[model samples]
Target: MKYHVVTLGCQMNMSDSERVISVLEEAGYQWTDNEEEAGVIGILACSVRQKAIDKVYSRIHKWNKWKNNKNLVTFISGCILPDDHEKFLKLFDITFQMKDLPELPKMISSYGITTPTHLNVGIDPHNENIEDFWNVQPHYQSNFEAFIPIQNGCDKFCTYCAVPYTRGREVSRPSKDIIAEVALLVAQGYKSITLLGQNVNSYGLDKKGEELTFPQLLREIGELGKRMKKEFWLYFTSPHPRDMTDEVIEVIAEYPVLGKQIHLPMQSGDDKVLMRMNRKHNMEKYRHIVETIRRIIPQATLFTDVIVGFTGETEEQFENTRKAFDEFKFNMSYTAIYSPRPGATSHRWVDDVPLEEKKRRLHQLTEDLRKHNLPYNESLVGQTVRILVRGEDRKEGFLTSYTEGKLTIRFACTDKSMIGQFADVKITSASDFSLEGELVEVAASC
Candidate 1:
C-alpha cells in the first residue's frame, strides 16, 4: 500500500501533513509522490484563502474521477472552515478534524483496507483530543529543518482571519513536550527548528497558571541549547502584535540559538485600516515594538505580513502603508490583496475596495518592498554568512540555502552531502529577492 498527501496553506499545515504521513506509514503503507500509484490519498486542506479552497475542489474532482477505475481512499484535514468542511464531506471518502488524526488508521480499516495492526477505533471526533494529535511523532520531511507546534488554534478574532472559526480557541501544548521535541531534533543534527502557532507569543495564556509563558519557553530552549554541543537556529511565526512583549525580545537577544529574525505582521500602516480589520494594536504600538526589537536585537532582520486595499481602504491609507514600507525597510513582506473569506467577520461588510485597485495596491507595496530589500542585500556583498544548504538550485552546479537571518542565497556547490549541513558562504552578488554567493567552507556536517 502507498499513500500520498497534498498539503496546502501555511507552514502549520505543512507540519500537520507530517503527522498524517506518520500515521499512514505506521499502518504499513509506503509513501509515494505519484498520486496514481497510491491506494490512499489525503489533502491537508486550507480554507483561509479562496484560492487555496479552489485548488482543493479542483484536485478532489480529478481524484474522484480516478476512483471510477482505481481503488483509493481519500480524506481531508487541517484549517478547514465549517462551510468548506460540509462540502468536503461529500467529495472525500472521510473528512475529519486534525485532532482526530490518531483514529485515521482505524478509519482506513473500516474502509476494508487491512494493516499490520488493529489500531484502537471509535475515538470521538467531537472531543478535544489535541493532546493525542500532538503525541503522534511527525515523519519529519526534512533532515535539517523541522517545525514543532507549541500551540494550536487562535483566540484573537481578527476580522480578516478564519483561524478562530476553523481551528477553534487557543490551546497550548505542554512546555515539557515542546522542550523534549526540540532537544531530540537538536540532538539528531537538525539545523533549524521553528516553533509553530497561530499566535505564538500568546502561548500558555490559556493555561494561565499551569504552562510556561512564551518567553519562559524560549528560556528553557536556550538552556537546552547551552547544554548541547550542536549549533542550530530557533524560530517561531505569525505571533499577534498585541501579545508581543518586551520580555520576548529580551529572551531572543539573550539566546544565540534563537535566530535574529522577527516576522511581526503589520497588516496595515494606517490606524483606521487596522481598526477596521480588528487587529487590536495601533500603528504607534507596532512602531514601538519595531523600535524595541531594533534596540535589543540590532543585527536582526525584519519580516512582515501586509494586506493591500482592505475593505473601505482609501488611496491615502494605501499611501500610508507605502510610507510604512519605506520606514520599516522590511527584508521581506508577505503581502496579499484582500479577499473576503466565507466565515470571517469581514465577509459581512462590503468589500468596497475595487479588484483592479486592490491588485494595483498589491503591486505598489511589492515595488516598495523591492526598493527596500535590494539595498540591504547589496550591503551584504563581500560579507561571509553561515547558511544551511537546503537543496540544489535550478542553475546547475549551485545549491540553495538561507542565511542566519533567513535570507535566500544560492551558492556554487556540487557536493550532495552538503544539502543537510551548514556552510559559510561569501556574498558575490545581490538581487531584489535573493543573493548569489560562493562557498567559503563547510561549517559543520550533520
Candidate 2:
C-alpha cells in the first residue's frame, strides 16, 4: 500500500508524523507525495486552532467524495478533541489516538484482508521505550536541518492551551538516549539540530530526584561537540518563561555548538492575564529572567511568543504587552489573536473582543515588535555570521542557510555541496524576514 501523510500543529505533530512514516515503511508500505495517488491517507491533526480543525474537515469532505468508488482508506489521529472525533468518524475510515499507534500494522493487515470484528481501544504505550519511536532513522526532509524532539507534552496546563489535554503531561527522554541520537546525527553529516518540545524547559522535571537532570542533560549534550569533534549548530524551541533556569542559560552561553537564539514564550505581558492563565510568573519576574539572561550572555538573541486580545483584556493591559516588547527589544516575536480553545479552563469565559479589534491589536503588537527586530537585522549588515547552508533558494540559484542565531540567510555560492556544511557569510543587506549575504569562507571539514 501507498500512503501520504499531512501534518498540522506544533513540531510534536511533525515528530509524530515522522514516527508514523517509519512504522508504515516497516509495515511494507510505500509513500507518495500526492495524496490523490495514495492507497491510504494519514492526517496528523491539531485541535488548538479552529481554522486548523476546519481545514481537516475540508480535506475529509474532499477525500470522502473521492473514496466512494476508490479503495483508499483515510486515517485521522493526533491531538484531536472529543467533539472533533465525532466529526472525524463521520468522514474518516479509521480514527485512533496517537498513543495507540504501534499496533497499527495489525489493524491495517486485518482490515486489508478482512475487517476486524473487535473494536480497537486506545492504549498508552510505555514512553520509556524511547527506542520504539526514536530508534528508526527518519527520512528527514531537510539535508542540513532536522527537528529532534527531546521531550513531549506540557505539564503547566495553561488555562488557554489544549496541549496538556491532547499531548498529556510532561515526559523527558533519558539524557543518554538524547545524546546518543544527536551523536549519530552529527556522524551522519547533519549540520543543524533543533530540539523540540511543548515546554523544553521542563525537560528534567519529570525525572525529579534522579541524577540526570535537565542541566546535566544539556551538559552531556554539550560535551558531544568536543567528543564527536563536530561544529554543527544545536538549538531548542518554545521554552516557557517560568522554566528558564540559570543552569540552562549558562550552558547555552558556554557551549559554542548551542545556538545563540532563545525562543522563550511570554504569552501575555499583563501580570493579571498571566495569573489567570496560570503561568505562575508575573511580568516583573519575566523581565528579571530576561535581564539575567542578557547579563550572562550579552550576544544572545531572543524571540518571544505573545498573545493579544485575550478575554477581558483592557486597553491598558494591551499597552503593557506592547511596552514589554519595546523594553525587551526581542529579535523576533510570534503574536497571535487569542481564540478560545475547547477543553481549556478559559473556554467558559466570554470571547468578547470584536474580530476587527483583535486583528488591530495583533497588527499593532507585530508592528511594535518590528521596531526592535528591524534594527537588529540591520545591525547584522557588514558582520560575518556562521551559517549552515541548507538548500537552493526558490527564486534563484542562490544558496540559503540558517545562521547560528537561527536567522535565515540567502547568499550566492558556487559550491552546491556546501548545502550540508557550515560556512561564514558576510551580511550585505537585511530585510524584515531574511538576511542577504556573500559567502566568506567554508569552515575546515570535521
Candidate 3:
C-alpha cells in the first residue's frame, strides 16, 4: 500500500511530516506524492490561521469522498486546538496526538493493516516527553537541508495564539538525543539544519536542571560543528521576544555554525496592542533585543513576524507598527492579518480591526520591507559569497541558492550536479527579496 502525507503551516510541520513518512513507510506503506494513488492519507496540519484550517477542511472533504469507491484510511495531527480537536476526532479515521505516534500502526491495525511495531504496542499511555516519537528517525526530504525538533509545545500563552491549547505546555527534549541527531546529520553531509519550536528561545526552561539551556545547547552544537569539520548553517525559529536574552546573541556571534539569520517576532509595535496580545515585553524591551543583535551580529539579516491588526487596535496604534518598519529596517517581515480563532484569549474579545484596514497595514509594511531589503541586497552587488545551491530555479537555465544569512539567490547554471553542494557566487544584480548572481566557485558537499 502507498501513503501520502499533506503538510501545511510552518517549518515545524514539515519536520513533523518527515517523521510521519518514516512511520508510514516502516508500517509497510510506500510513500507517494500523488494523493489519488494512495490507500492511506495523512495531514500534518496547522491551526494557527483560518486559511490553513480552511485548506484542511477542503482536503479532508475531498479525501473522504474517495472512500466511497476504494478502501482508504486517513489520519490527522499537529497544532490542532481543542475546539477543532472534538470535530477532527469524528472526521479522520484515526486522530492521535504527536506523542502517540508510536501507536499509529496499532491504530490502523483494526483495518487489517499491520506491522512489527503494531505487534509491540499494547495500549500503554505514552510518556510526556514523546520519547518514542523522538526515537523514530525522520525520513529527511532534503539532501542538503533538514529540520531538527529540539523541543515540543508552548508555555507562553499569547492572547492571540492557540499554541498553548493545541500543543500544551513547553517540554524540552533530552539534550543528549538532540546532540546525537545533529551529529549524525552532519556526518551524513546534511548542511542546512533548523531547530524548531513554537517559541524556540524558551527551550529547556521546562526541564531546567535536566536539559541544557538554549544557549548551552547552541554552544554544544557550535563546538560539535568545530570538531565535525563540516560546512553547514544552523538556525532556530520564532522565539518569543520576552525570552530572548543578550546571552543568546553573544552565543550566536561566537558560533560560526549558527546561521547569520535571526527570525525575531515583534507581533505588534504599539505597546497597548502588545499588551492586549499578552506579549509580556513592551516596545522598549523589544528594541533593546534588536539593538543588541545589531551591536553583536552586524552582518546578520534580521527577520520578524508582525500582526497588522488585533482586537481594539486604533488607527494611531497601527501607525506605530508602520513606523516600526522604518525604525527596524528589517530585511524581511511576515506581516499577518489577525483573525480570531477558538481557544485563544483574543477570541473572547471583539475583533475590532476591519479586514480592509488590516490589508492596508499589511501592504504598507510590505512596501516598507522592500525599501529596507533592496538596499541590503544591493550592497552585496560585486561581493562573492558562499551559498548552498538548492535546486533548479523556475526560470530556465537558472539555479537556486541561499547565503548563510538565508538570502535567496538565483544564478545561471547548466551543471545540475552542483545542486546539493556549496558554491561561491558573485552578485550581479539585486531585487527586493532575492539576488541574481553569477557562479564563481564550487566547494565541498553541503
Candidate of highest lDDT: 1
Candidate rank order under TM-score: 1, 3, 2
Alpha-carbon TM-score of each model against the true structure: 0.93, 0.92, 0.93
- The global C-alpha lDDT for each of the candidates, from Candidate 1 onward, is 0.89, 0.79, 0.85
Q: Tell me the deviation in Å of residue 375 in model 1.
A: 2.4
Tally clashing residue pairs in candidate 1: 0
Candidate 1 displacement at residue 329 in angstroms: 1.0
Predicted structure 3, TM vs. truth = 0.93
Worst 10 residues of 2 by lDDT: 116-125
Overall local distance difference test of candidate 2: 0.79
116: Cα error in model 1, Å: 23
CA lDDT, candidate 1, residue 431: 92
lDDT of 2 by residue, 197-254 (tens): 8888788888787737666777777888978888888888878878888888999888
> In model 1, which runs have C-alpha deviations exceeding 4 angstroms?
112-127, 442-446
List where candidate 3 sits over 4 angstroms from the true fold: 112-129, 442-446
* Per-candidate RMSD, Å: 3.4, 2.9, 3.4
